[model samples]
Target chain A: MDITINRGDFVGLLGPSGSGKTTLIKTILGATDVYGGEVRVEGQSIAERRPRVGYVPQLETIDWNFPVTVEQVVTMGRVRRGWWYPWQRREDRLVAHEMMSRLGIADFAARHVRELSGGQKQRALLARALVSSPRLLLLDEPTSGVDIKTRDEIMHLLDELNHQDVTVIMTTHEINAVAAHLPWVVCLNGGIVDSGPPADVFTPDTLRRTYNADILVTEYMGMKLVAESPHFFGRNERGSADSSERGEHVHAASV
Target chain B: MFTPLQYEFFVRALIVATLVGGLCGLIGVYVVLRRMSYIGHGLSHAIFGGAVASYVLSVNFFLGASVWGFVSALLINLATRKRSISADAAIGIVTTSSFALGVALISRFRSFTRSFDAALFGNILGITQADVIAIAAVALLAAAALFVGYKYLLFTTFEPEVARFYGVPAGWTDAGFSLLLAAVIVVSLQVLGVTMIAAAIVIPPVVARLLTDEFARMLLLSVVIGALCGLGGLYMSFYLDISSGASVVLFSAAVFLIALSYTTLRSRLGSARWRRRSAASGKLEPFH
Candidate 1:
């Protein structure tokens, strides 16, 4: 649908699988055909400018067996006009090293991306995205599957980048862990259901419209937390859910 | 080696083999990384169909075969652009159909199959001065294209979907690469043979992969290894009176076995030492 993201906006897109979250991200990156309307940076045509969008894709989409080092992946961001020659210039290497150091992946520069831990691999991909220093950054499920500590680290890094005036937009399913803390979020299902501060946009009706299922929301320490309707989660601490009830829970969760 | 050089035919064969070796290795990096290994095998056979058609039409073999193969490859590229059909499926569909056409034509002109012996299994003895120049010309074209498009190639190979996000002209890259692949197959027909070309293209890159974790090193190593194997196989063929194509592939296979053994042992020893160090320091294993 129609949306406007201002400079330094730290926005999260929340939606279910196949709800066009990743497709919207691809549309922004010009990876998909723009049939009806145009995407612009400010008022200028994106085509007029050089291709410099920074994208951090989902880790699940990566091929870990591919032979690439941290250094190599980072320099991949600089695959633009200046790289007409085969080898990387001294400045390319310097920029890659600087980005890696900033991301705390310098120690793993020579290591294969395959050998890295989950968070470390995310950081490597982040370093590659940021090496070009674009004004905008788009991440697809950046914090997905990460432990709490690693997730916090990555969020803080994104926060730090946002404070420096880089517009950050990420699509994620971790509504509680990630989208809850975002300054703004869009609840999307093919089109924008609603968008505002998390407390305002993450309403039960909006979430149900987005996920096609009832969801539970609560506030803790002034932050809104979301969970699947506990009627479907599992047995409570006291084992209240019966065997048939647990089977129902599994089916509901699958849905 | 010195004795073979005295004969002009041997010298021509040696030069063409070396060039084809390097070219195949260079392209093999992309082929293997993209998991399009079968395209090399399939496209070479498809190009053979074009070669057969060229003979019947009284067209220049290189020109006709290259165009036909290029068109076939582009169809495959376009077919897989949406990724509805996997790379293997696209290659198989196009290659088999094209090959079937060749078979149909051959039945009509029975004499055509006689000439195809050189193409099917390679005839290093048939390499002429013109073949030498054609192979070298294609090699230069390939080197220039690779040189200019190195970053795009690496980015595309590493992440095909993301490469488009960064302004890589994916369609053009695929089409250009298809043309190069067609030319490579056409030029290599006299030396590597259609049936054996896939092995030449696969072995060098795979061996390089086993030896290194770095992409740049793998690229360089594959080229060097391919060229050396080409030279070595030619020497062996001269002495052993074996098919040069077979000799080259057998040499590459031997090298692959050595590399596989070395890497496997290194990884085992490396893990063992890592375990020992972790126990000594009472630290948990870092990698899961």
Candidate 2:
């Protein structure tokens, strides 16, 4: 997919389960090989822009039983020394503590990370990503297993960060989560099926093209939402909910 | 026990056991935590090939075994990283082939086979001052590497992709760790032998895992368990006239079993007590 993510833009990369969202993120981080196209950050290739990019991996990607404290995990973001030096400077510790407080996890700074809830885990990871003060932050499935309230809180946190000029590009399988909160949503299947403001690209036809399944798209309070159509479960009585029609039931509650 | 310590060889053996035990324990935490216990097993077996080759060629045992073990570790790592080969398959192939080659080579010469028993099962009782120094040197190097890279090592062990994303050089970290594991295995051969060196690299961390969820505490606990196991095993071997390597492994396994049983029993009792208290408060409910 050909795309450009500008600074301070909160773009959510939306896709189905088997889509290339993770592959794209890995490619951006230079952790995987990019077969065809070039991925540049601020006119530089991803490999060259490594220092300016921060990453918050999915919660499941970490071994929570690893026995590291919250503050220690956040302090790993500092890039001041090579791996040969394991010590964290006082300034780095201060920054990590400050980030922990900002994320509302200061109370658990010395607690084992496995003791955290899913929401707290995501916040801790976010704090780690922000501790280094990178120009661009990349998150993968930040709210996948979190509760609805926690999901909203994470989205709000991302919005607040974006407003403060830290460019963000997070990937998620939840389409309505992106459509409701993200100003820009990139629908990704094997490639970018569509990319624009939510209103421009969150249509039923666009979602079907991206997901390769019939999806219901509807409007609620001037906002677009997407969900799997009820026809998929052999209940063909209700066709795909297009934007113009309002169903009796709220088919896309995620919005 | 006091009289045995008066002998120089016994003294050297104790020093070797103490250092190698703590060293293996320190490195073993990563091995256990990363679930790379099989790699340690594979490399330990692979070291036999190098031991046999160096004996036949009249070279330094440590040099040959370290080279072979190091090469085998890197090869196993490479095979697992490939898309086709599974980790267990890679380990099975590399370790068995290397060990088989060592056996075949030794069987060709009766003179070589005569001295192979000590190398196979270990001869800690016959440890020399040179062996002590070499073990001490490798132990120090391993300690330095771990101390310098503790944070990066922990980060990469738990989350490689995240560490790579932050420019932690995860690939280099992994390669360095593998080399360190190889060196530790080689140093451990004289005390634990090729057959049981992997156990020394695995058991303590496992016991610590059962006891604590914190990494730092796990490291400290694993080191202590290893040192104690070594001292106790050596004493048992001295008194019983048995194999020190086997004794050490048995001691470690016994400790692991005790820890497992204790933790399980405590959790069960704790839960049952909670249930009784809740029942007394009339909060118990029936299942559907």
- lDDT winner: 1
Task: Report the C-alpha displacement of residue A120, candidate 1, in angstroms.
Answer: 2.0
In candidate 1, position B43 carries an lDDT of: 96
lDDT value, candidate 2, whole model: 0.83
| Worst-scoring 10-residue span by lDDT in model 2 chain A | A228-237
Q: What local lDDT does model 1 show for residue A170?
A: 98
- Those runs of model 1 whose alpha carbons end farther than 4 Å from true positions after fitting are A44-51, A227-255, B1-8, B110-114, B273-288
Could you report the DockQ of all the candidates, in the order they appear? 0.50, 0.37
Residue pairs that clash (backbone atoms under 3 angstroms), model 1 = none
**lDDT by residue for model 1 over B169-255, one digit each (tens)?**
777887788899899989998898888999989999999999887887888999998898888888888889888788888888898
Candidate 2's C-alpha runs over 4 A off are A47-51, A79-85, A227-255, B1-3, B109-114, B276-288
The candidate that achieves the highest DockQ relative to the unseen native structure = 1
TM-score per model over all chains: 0.89, 0.90
Docking class of 2: acceptable
How would you encode candidate 2's per-residue C-alpha lDDT over B1-288 as one tens digit per residue?
Answer: 698898887777877777787888999999988878888888888888888888888888888888888889889988988879998899999999999998988788667744566777888976777788888899889888888888889888878667877778788889899888888998888888878888998999999888987788999999999988888788778888889898888888999899999999999998788778767877754421
Give Cα-based local distance difference scores for all models: 0.86, 0.83
lDDT for position B134 in model 1: 92
